[model samples]
Target: MTKANLLYPRKERVRKKQASPNFKAAGKSIEQRPESINKRDNSGDFEIDTVIQTRAKNECLLTLTDRKSRYQIIRLIPDKSADSVNQALRTILQEYQINSITADNGTEFSRLSDVFDPEHIYYAHPYSS
Candidate 1:
Protein backbone atom coordinates (compact mmCIF):
# COMPACT_ATOMS: atom_id res chain seq x y z
CA MET A 1 0.00 0.00 0.00
CA THR A 2 1.10 3.60 -0.62
CA LYS A 3 2.34 5.55 2.41
CA ALA A 4 -0.69 7.86 2.14
CA ASN A 5 -3.05 4.87 2.53
CA LEU A 6 -0.84 3.11 5.08
CA LEU A 7 -1.23 6.00 7.55
CA TYR A 8 -5.03 5.66 7.65
CA PRO A 9 -5.96 2.61 5.69
CA ARG A 10 -9.58 2.49 6.79
CA LYS A 11 -10.37 6.20 7.06
CA GLU A 12 -12.24 8.18 4.44
CA ARG A 13 -12.20 11.97 4.07
CA VAL A 14 -15.38 13.77 3.18
CA ARG A 15 -15.53 17.28 1.75
CA LYS A 16 -17.64 19.63 3.81
CA LYS A 17 -20.27 21.70 2.04
CA GLN A 18 -21.04 25.28 2.90
CA ALA A 19 -23.81 25.74 5.43
CA SER A 20 -25.33 28.52 3.41
CA PRO A 21 -25.05 30.00 -0.08
CA ASN A 22 -23.05 33.15 -0.69
CA PHE A 23 -25.37 35.98 0.35
CA LYS A 24 -23.54 38.98 -1.08
CA ALA A 25 -24.74 38.18 -4.56
CA ALA A 26 -28.30 38.84 -3.47
CA GLY A 27 -27.75 42.51 -2.72
CA LYS A 28 -27.33 45.60 -4.89
CA SER A 29 -24.20 45.02 -6.89
CA ILE A 30 -21.12 47.25 -6.75
CA GLU A 31 -21.80 48.14 -10.38
CA GLN A 32 -24.98 49.69 -9.04
CA ARG A 33 -23.00 52.07 -6.84
CA PRO A 34 -23.15 55.67 -8.07
CA GLU A 35 -20.80 56.70 -10.85
CA SER A 36 -20.27 59.94 -8.93
CA ILE A 37 -18.09 58.01 -6.47
CA ASN A 38 -15.27 58.01 -9.04
CA LYS A 39 -15.43 61.73 -9.76
CA ARG A 40 -13.47 64.31 -7.81
CA ASP A 41 -15.09 66.23 -4.93
CA ASN A 42 -17.67 63.58 -4.22
CA SER A 43 -17.37 64.26 -0.55
CA GLY A 44 -20.26 62.44 1.07
CA ASP A 45 -19.46 58.79 0.39
CA PHE A 46 -16.86 56.84 2.35
CA GLU A 47 -15.54 53.38 3.15
CA ILE A 48 -14.42 52.59 6.66
CA ASP A 49 -12.48 49.86 8.43
CA THR A 50 -10.87 49.30 11.80
CA VAL A 51 -7.20 48.47 12.32
CA ILE A 52 -6.35 46.62 15.50
CA GLN A 53 -2.96 46.32 17.14
CA THR A 54 -1.64 42.77 17.17
CA ARG A 55 0.01 43.09 20.54
CA ALA A 56 -2.59 45.20 22.33
CA LYS A 57 -6.04 43.82 22.94
CA ASN A 58 -7.70 47.20 23.33
CA GLU A 59 -5.80 49.40 20.90
CA CYS A 60 -7.35 50.10 17.53
CA LEU A 61 -7.14 52.46 14.58
CA LEU A 62 -10.16 53.60 12.70
CA THR A 63 -9.56 54.28 9.01
CA LEU A 64 -11.97 56.21 6.79
CA THR A 65 -11.60 56.65 3.03
CA ASP A 66 -13.35 59.27 0.93
CA ARG A 67 -14.56 57.49 -2.18
CA LYS A 68 -14.07 60.37 -4.60
CA SER A 69 -10.91 62.19 -3.62
CA ARG A 70 -9.38 59.08 -2.10
CA TYR A 71 -8.81 61.12 1.04
CA GLN A 72 -8.17 59.11 4.21
CA ILE A 73 -8.31 59.78 7.93
CA ILE A 74 -7.09 57.60 10.76
CA ARG A 75 -7.95 57.75 14.43
CA LEU A 76 -6.16 55.81 17.12
CA ILE A 77 -8.23 54.78 20.10
CA PRO A 78 -7.63 52.94 23.36
CA ASP A 79 -10.45 50.49 22.78
CA LYS A 80 -13.24 49.36 20.42
CA SER A 81 -16.11 50.36 22.65
CA ALA A 82 -19.19 51.89 21.09
CA ASP A 83 -18.58 55.17 22.85
CA SER A 84 -15.08 55.40 21.44
CA VAL A 85 -16.23 54.51 17.95
CA ASN A 86 -19.09 56.99 18.16
CA GLN A 87 -16.75 59.73 19.28
CA ALA A 88 -14.30 58.96 16.47
CA LEU A 89 -17.08 58.97 13.90
CA ARG A 90 -18.46 62.21 15.25
CA THR A 91 -15.05 63.81 15.00
CA ILE A 92 -14.59 62.64 11.43
CA LEU A 93 -18.10 63.70 10.45
CA GLN A 94 -17.56 67.10 11.95
CA GLU A 95 -14.41 67.58 9.88
CA TYR A 96 -16.30 66.67 6.74
CA GLN A 97 -20.05 66.68 6.29
CA ILE A 98 -20.26 62.96 5.55
CA ASN A 99 -23.59 61.85 4.05
CA SER A 100 -23.06 58.09 3.86
CA ILE A 101 -20.62 55.40 4.94
CA THR A 102 -20.11 51.76 4.02
CA ALA A 103 -18.63 49.29 6.43
CA ASP A 104 -18.33 45.59 7.07
CA ASN A 105 -20.49 43.91 9.68
CA GLY A 106 -18.88 44.63 13.00
CA THR A 107 -20.40 45.01 16.45
CA GLU A 108 -18.51 48.28 16.97
CA PHE A 109 -20.81 49.95 14.44
CA SER A 110 -24.04 48.64 15.95
CA ARG A 111 -24.76 51.91 17.69
CA LEU A 112 -24.58 54.05 14.57
CA SER A 113 -28.23 54.97 14.89
CA ASP A 114 -27.52 56.47 18.31
CA VAL A 115 -24.82 58.72 16.84
CA PHE A 116 -26.42 59.69 13.52
CA ASP A 117 -29.86 59.99 12.04
CA PRO A 118 -30.97 56.72 10.49
CA GLU A 119 -32.36 58.51 7.44
CA HIS A 120 -28.96 59.98 6.69
CA ILE A 121 -26.83 56.91 7.33
CA TYR A 122 -26.96 53.73 5.30
CA TYR A 123 -25.37 50.42 6.25
CA ALA A 124 -24.22 47.69 3.94
CA HIS A 125 -26.07 44.47 4.62
CA PRO A 126 -24.32 42.24 7.14
CA TYR A 127 -24.30 39.18 4.90
CA SER A 128 -22.84 41.05 1.96
CA SER A 129 -19.29 39.81 1.72
Candidate 2:
Protein backbone atom coordinates (compact mmCIF):
# COMPACT_ATOMS: atom_id res chain seq x y z
CA MET A 1 0.00 0.00 0.00
CA THR A 2 1.06 3.62 -0.51
CA LYS A 3 2.34 5.70 2.41
CA ALA A 4 -0.72 7.93 2.11
CA ASN A 5 -2.99 4.89 2.34
CA LEU A 6 -1.13 3.78 5.43
CA LEU A 7 -1.81 7.15 7.10
CA TYR A 8 1.90 7.88 7.39
CA PRO A 9 3.05 11.31 8.42
CA ARG A 10 3.55 13.69 5.51
CA LYS A 11 7.07 14.83 4.86
CA GLU A 12 7.70 18.49 4.18
CA ARG A 13 9.56 19.47 1.12
CA VAL A 14 12.49 21.78 1.69
CA ARG A 15 12.87 24.60 -0.78
CA LYS A 16 16.37 25.34 -2.03
CA LYS A 17 17.78 28.74 -1.22
CA GLN A 18 18.24 31.22 -4.05
CA ALA A 19 21.69 31.66 -5.56
CA SER A 20 23.62 34.88 -5.10
CA PRO A 21 23.82 37.27 -8.06
CA ASN A 22 27.39 38.20 -7.28
CA PHE A 23 28.72 34.72 -7.94
CA LYS A 24 29.78 34.41 -11.59
CA ALA A 25 31.71 31.86 -13.58
CA ALA A 26 35.37 32.67 -14.08
CA GLY A 27 35.47 31.22 -17.61
CA LYS A 28 33.59 31.13 -20.90
CA SER A 29 29.88 30.40 -21.09
CA ILE A 30 28.66 27.06 -22.45
CA GLU A 31 26.91 28.89 -25.28
CA GLN A 32 30.35 29.55 -26.75
CA ARG A 33 31.22 25.83 -26.91
CA PRO A 34 32.22 24.72 -30.38
CA GLU A 35 29.84 22.63 -32.47
CA SER A 36 32.16 19.59 -32.35
CA ILE A 37 32.09 19.52 -28.56
CA ASN A 38 28.30 20.04 -28.53
CA LYS A 39 27.81 17.06 -30.82
CA ARG A 40 30.17 14.86 -28.69
CA ASP A 41 32.38 14.44 -31.74
CA ASN A 42 35.63 14.90 -29.84
CA SER A 43 37.39 12.58 -27.41
CA GLY A 44 39.13 15.02 -25.11
CA ASP A 45 36.00 17.09 -24.43
CA PHE A 46 34.85 16.53 -20.86
CA GLU A 47 32.23 17.55 -18.29
CA ILE A 48 33.11 18.10 -14.65
CA ASP A 49 31.07 17.66 -11.48
CA THR A 50 31.58 17.24 -7.76
CA VAL A 51 29.82 14.80 -5.45
CA ILE A 52 29.91 16.13 -1.91
CA GLN A 53 29.61 14.01 1.17
CA THR A 54 26.80 15.69 3.09
CA ARG A 55 27.25 13.70 6.29
CA ALA A 56 31.02 13.68 6.26
CA LYS A 57 33.45 16.40 7.20
CA ASN A 58 35.51 17.94 4.40
CA GLU A 59 35.46 15.16 1.83
CA CYS A 60 34.16 14.94 -1.74
CA LEU A 61 34.62 13.32 -5.13
CA LEU A 62 35.67 15.30 -8.18
CA THR A 63 34.63 13.75 -11.45
CA LEU A 64 35.43 14.31 -15.13
CA THR A 65 33.62 12.47 -17.86
CA ASP A 66 34.34 12.41 -21.56
CA ARG A 67 31.26 13.46 -23.53
CA LYS A 68 31.72 11.06 -26.41
CA SER A 69 33.21 7.93 -24.82
CA ARG A 70 31.64 8.42 -21.38
CA TYR A 71 35.04 7.61 -19.84
CA GLN A 72 35.18 8.91 -16.28
CA ILE A 73 37.91 9.89 -13.86
CA ILE A 74 37.07 10.16 -10.17
CA ARG A 75 39.28 11.64 -7.52
CA LEU A 76 38.76 11.91 -3.78
CA ILE A 77 39.37 15.46 -2.73
CA PRO A 78 39.82 16.81 0.80
CA ASP A 79 37.21 19.55 0.46
CA LYS A 80 34.78 21.23 -1.92
CA SER A 81 36.85 24.38 -2.30
CA ALA A 82 38.03 25.58 -5.69
CA ASP A 83 41.67 25.10 -4.74
CA SER A 84 41.05 21.49 -3.84
CA VAL A 85 39.31 20.89 -7.17
CA ASN A 86 42.14 22.47 -9.09
CA GLN A 87 44.80 20.45 -7.29
CA ALA A 88 42.89 17.25 -7.79
CA LEU A 89 42.49 17.94 -11.50
CA ARG A 90 46.14 18.73 -11.93
CA THR A 91 47.17 15.45 -10.35
CA ILE A 92 44.53 13.47 -12.17
CA LEU A 93 45.14 14.86 -15.64
CA GLN A 94 48.91 15.24 -15.62
CA GLU A 95 49.51 12.80 -18.46
CA TYR A 96 46.31 13.29 -20.40
CA GLN A 97 45.30 15.54 -23.26
CA ILE A 98 42.34 17.85 -22.83
CA ASN A 99 40.20 19.69 -25.37
CA SER A 100 37.52 21.44 -23.30
CA ILE A 101 35.66 21.20 -20.00
CA THR A 102 32.02 22.09 -19.28
CA ALA A 103 31.07 22.58 -15.65
CA ASP A 104 28.31 24.16 -13.60
CA ASN A 105 28.75 27.53 -11.92
CA GLY A 106 29.56 26.06 -8.53
CA THR A 107 32.02 27.69 -6.18
CA GLU A 108 34.13 24.55 -6.19
CA PHE A 109 34.64 24.96 -9.92
CA SER A 110 35.48 28.64 -9.79
CA ARG A 111 39.19 27.97 -10.30
CA LEU A 112 38.80 25.60 -13.23
CA SER A 113 40.47 28.04 -15.57
CA ASP A 114 43.60 27.85 -13.42
CA VAL A 115 43.85 24.09 -13.94
CA PHE A 116 42.72 24.08 -17.57
CA ASP A 117 43.03 26.75 -20.19
CA PRO A 118 40.62 29.66 -19.77
CA GLU A 119 39.70 29.52 -23.42
CA HIS A 120 38.90 25.80 -23.14
CA ILE A 121 36.70 26.04 -20.06
CA TYR A 122 32.92 26.44 -20.35
CA TYR A 123 30.41 27.14 -17.59
CA ALA A 124 26.76 26.20 -17.62
CA HIS A 125 24.11 28.83 -16.93
CA PRO A 126 23.23 29.39 -13.29
CA TYR A 127 20.47 27.04 -12.05
CA SER A 128 20.41 25.42 -15.49
CA SER A 129 21.78 22.08 -14.28
Candidate 3:
Protein backbone atom coordinates (compact mmCIF):
# COMPACT_ATOMS: atom_id res chain seq x y z
CA MET A 1 0.00 0.00 0.00
CA THR A 2 1.09 3.55 -0.65
CA LYS A 3 2.00 5.91 2.21
CA ALA A 4 -1.42 7.69 1.86
CA ASN A 5 -3.29 4.32 2.02
CA LEU A 6 -1.25 3.30 5.06
CA LEU A 7 -2.05 6.63 6.72
CA TYR A 8 -5.77 6.15 6.04
CA PRO A 9 -5.69 2.41 6.81
CA ARG A 10 -8.10 1.69 3.95
CA LYS A 11 -11.28 2.55 5.86
CA GLU A 12 -14.71 1.45 4.62
CA ARG A 13 -16.28 3.38 1.80
CA VAL A 14 -18.41 6.28 2.97
CA ARG A 15 -22.04 6.25 1.91
CA LYS A 16 -23.28 9.25 -0.03
CA LYS A 17 -26.08 11.15 1.60
CA GLN A 18 -29.25 11.94 -0.30
CA ALA A 19 -29.57 15.55 -1.35
CA SER A 20 -32.11 17.64 0.50
CA PRO A 21 -34.56 19.98 -1.20
CA ASN A 22 -33.25 23.45 -1.88
CA PHE A 23 -36.57 25.10 -2.65
CA LYS A 24 -39.64 25.40 -0.43
CA ALA A 25 -43.08 24.32 -1.56
CA ALA A 26 -45.90 26.79 -1.19
CA GLY A 27 -49.65 26.17 -0.85
CA LYS A 28 -50.79 22.59 -0.25
CA SER A 29 -47.90 20.21 0.38
CA ILE A 30 -47.57 16.59 -0.68
CA GLU A 31 -48.21 15.50 2.90
CA GLN A 32 -51.65 17.09 2.78
CA ARG A 33 -52.57 15.26 -0.42
CA PRO A 34 -54.98 12.38 -0.04
CA GLU A 35 -53.56 8.89 0.51
CA SER A 36 -55.73 7.65 -2.33
CA ILE A 37 -53.60 9.67 -4.78
CA ASN A 38 -50.59 7.63 -3.75
CA LYS A 39 -52.48 4.39 -4.39
CA ARG A 40 -52.46 5.22 -8.14
CA ASP A 41 -55.40 2.93 -8.83
CA ASN A 42 -57.97 5.41 -10.00
CA SER A 43 -57.88 7.69 -12.99
CA GLY A 44 -58.15 11.50 -13.02
CA ASP A 45 -55.13 11.88 -10.70
CA PHE A 46 -52.46 13.72 -12.64
CA GLU A 47 -48.99 15.19 -12.26
CA ILE A 48 -47.71 18.14 -14.21
CA ASP A 49 -44.25 19.55 -14.87
CA THR A 50 -42.53 22.02 -17.16
CA VAL A 51 -39.58 20.97 -19.33
CA ILE A 52 -37.20 23.42 -20.87
CA GLN A 53 -35.33 21.82 -23.75
CA THR A 54 -32.29 24.01 -23.28
CA ARG A 55 -31.18 27.20 -21.63
CA ALA A 56 -31.16 29.06 -24.93
CA LYS A 57 -34.56 27.83 -25.94
CA ASN A 58 -37.28 30.40 -25.39
CA GLU A 59 -40.06 27.81 -25.47
CA CYS A 60 -40.83 25.12 -22.95
CA LEU A 61 -43.00 22.05 -22.72
CA LEU A 62 -45.90 21.68 -20.37
CA THR A 63 -46.16 18.02 -19.44
CA LEU A 64 -49.10 16.34 -17.75
CA THR A 65 -49.32 12.68 -16.87
CA ASP A 66 -52.04 10.59 -15.37
CA ARG A 67 -50.77 8.76 -12.32
CA LYS A 68 -53.11 5.82 -12.81
CA SER A 69 -53.04 5.36 -16.58
CA ARG A 70 -49.67 6.98 -17.21
CA TYR A 71 -51.24 8.89 -20.04
CA GLN A 72 -49.09 11.85 -20.92
CA ILE A 73 -50.03 15.18 -22.44
CA ILE A 74 -47.49 17.65 -23.70
CA ARG A 75 -47.92 21.21 -24.85
CA LEU A 76 -45.35 23.59 -26.23
CA ILE A 77 -45.39 27.15 -24.99
CA PRO A 78 -43.49 30.23 -26.07
CA ASP A 79 -42.80 31.02 -22.44
CA LYS A 80 -42.74 29.22 -19.09
CA SER A 81 -44.21 32.00 -17.02
CA ALA A 82 -47.05 31.46 -14.58
CA ASP A 83 -49.58 33.02 -16.92
CA SER A 84 -48.58 30.87 -19.87
CA VAL A 85 -48.63 27.69 -17.82
CA ASN A 86 -51.92 28.62 -16.23
CA GLN A 87 -53.47 29.17 -19.65
CA ALA A 88 -52.08 25.89 -20.95
CA LEU A 89 -53.52 24.06 -17.97
CA ARG A 90 -56.85 25.73 -18.52
CA THR A 91 -56.90 24.40 -22.08
CA ILE A 92 -55.88 20.93 -20.94
CA LEU A 93 -58.57 20.83 -18.25
CA GLN A 94 -61.10 21.59 -20.90
CA GLU A 95 -60.02 18.45 -22.73
CA TYR A 96 -59.12 16.13 -19.82
CA GLN A 97 -61.24 15.10 -16.90
CA ILE A 98 -58.68 15.75 -14.22
CA ASN A 99 -60.05 15.35 -10.72
CA SER A 100 -56.81 16.12 -8.94
CA ILE A 101 -53.29 17.23 -9.84
CA THR A 102 -49.82 16.93 -8.28
CA ALA A 103 -47.42 19.61 -9.40
CA ASP A 104 -43.98 20.79 -8.44
CA ASN A 105 -43.89 24.02 -6.48
CA GLY A 106 -42.10 26.10 -9.13
CA THR A 107 -42.62 29.76 -9.83
CA GLU A 108 -44.39 28.93 -13.07
CA PHE A 109 -46.98 27.08 -11.03
CA SER A 110 -47.18 29.63 -8.23
CA ARG A 111 -50.67 30.76 -9.19
CA LEU A 112 -51.99 27.38 -10.31
CA SER A 113 -54.68 27.23 -7.68
CA ASP A 114 -55.89 30.58 -8.91
CA VAL A 115 -56.28 29.09 -12.36
CA PHE A 116 -57.63 25.87 -10.87
CA ASP A 117 -59.29 25.36 -7.55
CA PRO A 118 -56.88 24.82 -4.65
CA GLU A 119 -59.03 21.94 -3.42
CA HIS A 120 -58.40 20.07 -6.68
CA ILE A 121 -54.67 20.71 -6.84
CA TYR A 122 -51.77 19.47 -4.70
CA TYR A 123 -48.21 20.72 -4.84
CA ALA A 124 -45.46 18.17 -4.44
CA HIS A 125 -43.06 18.96 -1.65
CA PRO A 126 -39.48 19.94 -2.42
CA TYR A 127 -36.99 17.17 -3.36
CA SER A 128 -39.91 14.96 -4.33
CA SER A 129 -40.98 13.54 -7.62
Provide TM-scores for the models. Answer: 0.65, 0.80, 0.77
Better candidate by TM-score, 1 or 2: 2
Predicted candidate 2 versus true structure: per-residue lDDT over 30-82, tens digit per residue: 98999999999879998999998898898999989999999999989999999
| lDDT of the candidates, in the order given | 0.69, 0.88, 0.84
Better lDDT candidate (2, 3):
2
Residue-level error in angstroms, candidate 3, position 111 = 0.4
Candidate 3 lDDT over 1-129, as tens digits, reads: 675758557667888554366655657778888888999878999998999978756899999999998999999988989999999999998988998888887889889987788887788756456
Cα lDDT for residue 68, model 2?
97
lDDT order, best first, reads 2, 3, 1
Query: How does residue 122 of candidate 1 score in lDDT?
Result: 45
After aligning candidate 1 to the native by TM-score, how far in Å is the CA of 5 from where it should be? Answer: 8.0
Query: Per-residue CA lDDT of candidate 1, range 1-117, in tens?
Result: 775768667666886544245544222334455556535356868777788999987899988888877789899977987788889988877877776666665677667767766
As for TM-score, the candidate ahead, 2 or 3, is 2
* Residue 77 displacement in candidate 3 (angstroms): 0.9
